[model samples]
Target: MPAPAHRLGLGLAAIARPAYITSGRAGELGDDRDVATLRDRSRALLDAAYAAGVRYLDVARSYGRAEEFLAGWLADRPGVTGGEDPVEIGSKWGYRYVGGWRTDADTHEVKDHSLDAFTEQYALSRELLGDHLGTYHVHSATLDTGVLDDGRVHRAMAHLRDRGIRVGISTSGPAQADAVRRALDVRVDGEPLFTSFQSTWNPLEPSVGPALAEAADAGARVIVKEVFANGRLAPGGEDGTEGARAAAALAARTGVPLDRIAVAAALANPWAWRVLLGPVGTDQLASNLAGAELTLPADAAEELTALAEPAEHYWATRSARPWS
Candidate 1:
């Protein structure tokens, strides 16, 4: 396999860290045991993605040294991703890793979407990723967080934009639609500061789709994440649950993997400029690429929308997932 033959407009998430401490399929999949091991795996993953026609890489400051891992991988494989057009590296600030690679840590990440947090994380990201960094996003933007409303943060983002780096925000929680709408209103001297937006849009939580379309119509590129609901759409996950059953039924009817059906549903949204697939290995990545190319039947797509859960309930279940 020389990688997927078609462009999927996909991005890779480098937060496969917790696999270091646990033991199982997921553990093995996320196993970034040490800096050296992580660097090697990161390079392999990135190589696989580029060969497969993926051009975007998404990471975060709190993703347990993801910036460092990506920088090392890029340094080793210069210009290999596609000659004139190289990979685009988009990373997020506003969170810091406190897990210290511990499996028993009470809190693995701490969020702080303040101006000062951006100040520190921005410089740190620059120091680590150097010239490879493209876009910097406010990690997990929520309505109450004020990252989108703060004028000072907007000015700071303006400064970064002046330097030619695209600015954006990643949203989470039940209020994702509200946050995405608010981000669209962010202006730096009467011009929109955000050129990109990433949000969760899976069968479990599809309410944000319209807002994402609004952002796209406003000239911002929309990237869809969590299309599988953080693994809920995969086999061995929520087997007896309604969402799982629905996805499985669709998969069997369409002759696609459950994960593919989940991702394809998200990609079917016209507003999604890029749909991220965070695969733990090359095999999973390949499957995701295939899913990205699928165009689900009109009936199947509409039925998937009916599986949407209340945003509150969906987020509650996601939050309850133990950090692996």
Candidate 2:
């Protein structure tokens, strides 16, 4: 029998390029010499995530051939439904991989949300992912980028929707909440264009949750990213801030790992359809899956919820993250 697909609320992310990049031992993921190794590693991660009951996998064009890696892994799986694979794939455009897999590249990626960029990256993503591709989003849509206000882009998105492809936006920056609210308001000829959204929501930067809840209430599928605040809530994380301390206290009280408690907090949100797990290895993935099973006590949850930092401070700290 085929593996049953998980509900929309849980998924995996390939941002770490696990197999292709050597991580931990070196400050960087492995170099080009590690392509085969990285592929194997990513494949193992996918296998584990599926076994752990994750059905949605998020990747982006800027994630260094993540689309290709996902395609290779999905080739062997049968669809949960009759023809479509049980796994739902969500990939984004608007960012290009400029790193060439080199650790020393001055810039690893460059973001462009122009109509031409969408045209090119969409074709590239489609070519690489084929039928396995499910939803496509405009990566990191900001108020300044004006992606939401562009009629041409809306037309393109609406056309994709008409063809049965789900369209949405992934937002970044301090104004992420505002961006989400605007995205929810976008429409082409009376029908809403976006049915999905990927946004950041963690203890330190949860300013977007209410907006996400609004999106969810409006019938959009909401995927939460950065639940661990880019590892800030992990054990002995670099931030050393109050949010991290709260996570540690919760872990001690519950006897769960700090990471697990952090992720569990995000899962507790009813509006989050899927809280993405950015595990870099089998052990991390296992830890995250365990977190998914935890139900935090209401008081503990309230303590964690109160850890939210001002949106500006949170995004500033995020902006300074060393591009891992």
Candidate 3:
């Protein structure tokens, strides 16, 4: 069955900033990395996405003004501004963008999952996004960060949850399953703290699937991100990888682009409440949305599962992808 329109979201990770880790960004975005240029580009993509039936938008403090760009788009768009056509906005904190908008910056973002970091970043996000922000997540929560164990952070997130904002965690690294399991156990005021989970889940790294399914069973909203494996499953992506090659072969046989196939794979996950699309432009967004309409053959779906790589190896390759 095809994924519903409401089951898809637009993530502003690549367009809100000039340089991102997604492959083909250099070709898609070109040399125009200025703030104004990117802001305009972000708004254009947001407009296109909303028109294409995407009602959920994801951003982050570490995404180099992604929250600000989204705020601007919300303010400028008439129907969206007045809630005539409301869209759910989800943003992450705990990471500060230190790239200074430069592609060659030694460090792009710095993670600090401390309560102090949450207090400061949450205020900034609310100042910009205001009532439009429906959900807030810990940018990249892992066991090492101790965020799951931090009582202060849990209290703060719980306070937000009480105020009608959905609290969640966006997991990263190879131990995503571990993080999701840990977060599921977190509670505040004797109640579950996190009700939303955004994590990377693609054919190359399907390690988090079982844990995410458990989260869904626990009544948590499960959002799947990085479905393209940081663009490795997209058109002109790194086809040398085994998973990418399998996806490409399937695409060729089915007459569907590799990107769409990737999207279809993510949408096929019964536990996935929403699949995020990180397209650089309108054309890419259209191509990705088409995947929602695609229902892969059962044999093809089984073949894709065999392409799963070791979680550690998959993450290592993703880490080496330069921010271009």
Candidate 4:
């Protein structure tokens, strides 16, 4: 098995925008969320992640200048952006950032999975990241969005695949299993259109495990996101829920932080190719990286497994979280 550090990736979601749905943002980022401040913070995080041996970087169009921040950081690093061992970069489309850099924006992003949306976002992503962009995913692709069933979108993504860029889908909500299974059936010119999959999988909500396993079996790269459940499992995070309480107890007994335990749980899944960590600061990044060193015992892992909540309840709690 590859070292956990090698399998860990940094997600630029929390730092790319002024506000996100993740908990503990107020304490982590405070009120200094201006564009330049966040840009600098993003660069600092990229520096720390690269220095710590984290190579895979996740970004998206709806992540409010995340792609732009990554582009700038890559430009500063000559050999890091290209060459044989360049960092693996994955980005997503299908949603437009509408927050206008405002933390109080009524609508932060608007989703449109149409061919037109793909065309526009693909052009923008290419314009910003250029060839550094490795895999492109459909942001929050659900069955109801018809993204998996859209033949035109598949053909467009197939064109990118021909150009050597891998295409995939990132799933969300309670129906992640349904979406992942459906995406597995998507084909273009008799070939699999998507070779990568990203989905939320933490100790608290692991309902998509079976589908992700099937995706990995199909030779798809399975990436786990929201491993900390949007900061609810992180230190100083919300611990009111039953799942969170159980995780806290386990963490207490094991003398490990909840964030590290969360990361270990996600990494324990053999099917996970890259487990993403969303950290707003270097301290959090360091703590999360240490999780890669942990060897979670089987019994302890099972104890955490008992923390699983119904997919509906998990997502409902997530949706109700205030965007700070």
Top lDDT: which candidate number? 4
TM-score of every prediction relative to native = 0.92, 0.90, 0.97, 0.98
The model with the greater lDDT, 1 or 2, is: 1
CA lDDT for candidate 4:
0.92
Q: Show pairs that collide, candidate 1.
A: none
Of the two candidates 1 and 4, the one with more favorable TM-score, higher being better, is 4
Cα lDDT tens digits, model 3, 6-62, are 789999999887778998778888898799999888898898888877889999999
Q: At residue 322, what lDDT does model 2 achieve?
A: 58
C-alpha lDDT (0 to 100) for residue 296 of candidate 3: 89
lDDT of each: 0.77, 0.76, 0.90, 0.92
Cand. 4 TM to true fold:
0.98
TM-score of 1: 0.92
Instruction: Write model 1 residue lDDT over 1-324, tens digit each, in one string.
Output: 233323344443434455321112364454446656655666677778888777878888887767777777787788744477677889999998887876578878899988899999999999988867888999899889877889999999899898889999999999999998888988898888988998988888988989999999998988888877777786445536687688778777878787778777877777888788776667777787777667788898888878898999888877777656
Residues 1-324 of candidate 4 have per-residue lDDT tens digits of 235589999999999999899888779898999999999999999999988888899999999999999999999897786665569999999999999899898999999999999999999999999989999999999999888998989999999999999999999999999999999998888999989999999988999999999999999999999999988898888659888877888889989998998998899999999999999999999999999999899999889888899999999999888777
The CA root-mean-square deviation of candidate 2, after full C-alpha superposition on the true structure, stands at 3.2
Off by over 4 Å in 3: 1-3, 81-85
Instruction: Put down candidate 2 lDDT per residue, 1-324, tens digits, no spaces.
Output: 122224323333434342222123232233443557667767788888777678788899888867877777777665532354366889998988887765556687889989999999999988888767789999999889889899999998798899888999998889998999898889998999988989989887888989999999999999988777777776545366776777777778878787778777888788988888776667767776777667788888898878889999888877766554
